[model samples]
Target: MSVEVNNETDYEVDLHDVQKLADSITEAMFIHPETEVSIVFIDEDAMSELHVEWMDLEGPTDVMSFPMDELRPGSETAPSESGILGDIVICPTIAEAQAKAGGHAVHDEILLLTTHGMLHLMGFDHEEPEEKAEMFTLQRRLLEGYTGRPAPKETVE
Candidate 1:
């Protein structure tokens, strides 16, 4: 799996860890022998600008995902053997603040973002309550499964 992560932030969000987490997520899918996702980490300012430009929002967001396929939400869209899945952009500064506010570690928050973005890439959405539940369930499973082996204590702690 090629997790081509482009870090555009000053805050040190471990690119290696992010890549491993992404690879584990792909592994959990099991269907795709190879998968690729581009992860970009940016600062609050850049995120805010992107939010406004792309999403027409005024403030920074923790993360934003741009799925390559146009598959309707709630439908599965597997990557071709080429392995290009989609793209995920993250903001670590906002993530840390959100993590503190949400009472979770920064890593946990980032993992959640990655999972959420991946679900979107796989054609999932939270436009409705049921859909949201389904997506969240999948996200939790991926996160737990990935962190379970790599950093057991930290995963829980």
Candidate 2:
């Protein structure tokens, strides 16, 4: 899978690790190897602007997904079509505060959000209770499977 991670923020994150997690998820979910997905790390200001522009919200959210092709999950025999899976934009500043409150590493929280955003890209919604359960259950499963392996570490630049 062509998972491109672009760190536009000053936060010290392991770009490769995030990309690997995304790649693993897409591969496991049967997304085509030619499909393109971008994970972008941005500052709070940029995120907030996007939040307002796209979602018409007030403040910066942890993550936001902008899907392009509306791709759905496919089976092993028939993978999803190759196309732009869209962008998952995350704000590290917001993530850090959430991690502190959740008592987990920032990277782990980011991974959770990444998976959450991925689910959204795959047309999973949580506006309703049933949708919430299904999406969250899958999210938890994906995160659990990924955490079993050693996730990438943050590097100080």
**How much is the lDDT of residue 130 in candidate 1?**
94
Q: What TM-scores do the predictions have?
A: 0.83, 0.93
Worst lDDT 10-window in candidate 2: 148-157
Candidate that scores best on TM-score = 2
Q: On residues 12-90, what C-alpha lDDT tens digit does candidate 2 reach at each position?
A: 9888888988998898899999999999999999998999999899899999999999999889999999999999998
Clashing pairs in 1: none
Question: Which ranges in model 2 have alpha carbons more than 4 Å from their true place?
Answer: 149-157
lDDT tens per residue, model 1, 24-76: 77666642545567999988888899889998999989888887743232213
Candidate 1 least-lDDT 10 residues: 148-157
Candidates in order: C-alpha RMSD to true structure: 4.9, 4.7
Off by over 4 Å in 1: 70-83, 149-157
Q: How many clashes does each candidate structure show, in the order listed?
A: 0, 0
| lDDT (CA) per prediction | 0.73, 0.86
Best by lDDT: 2
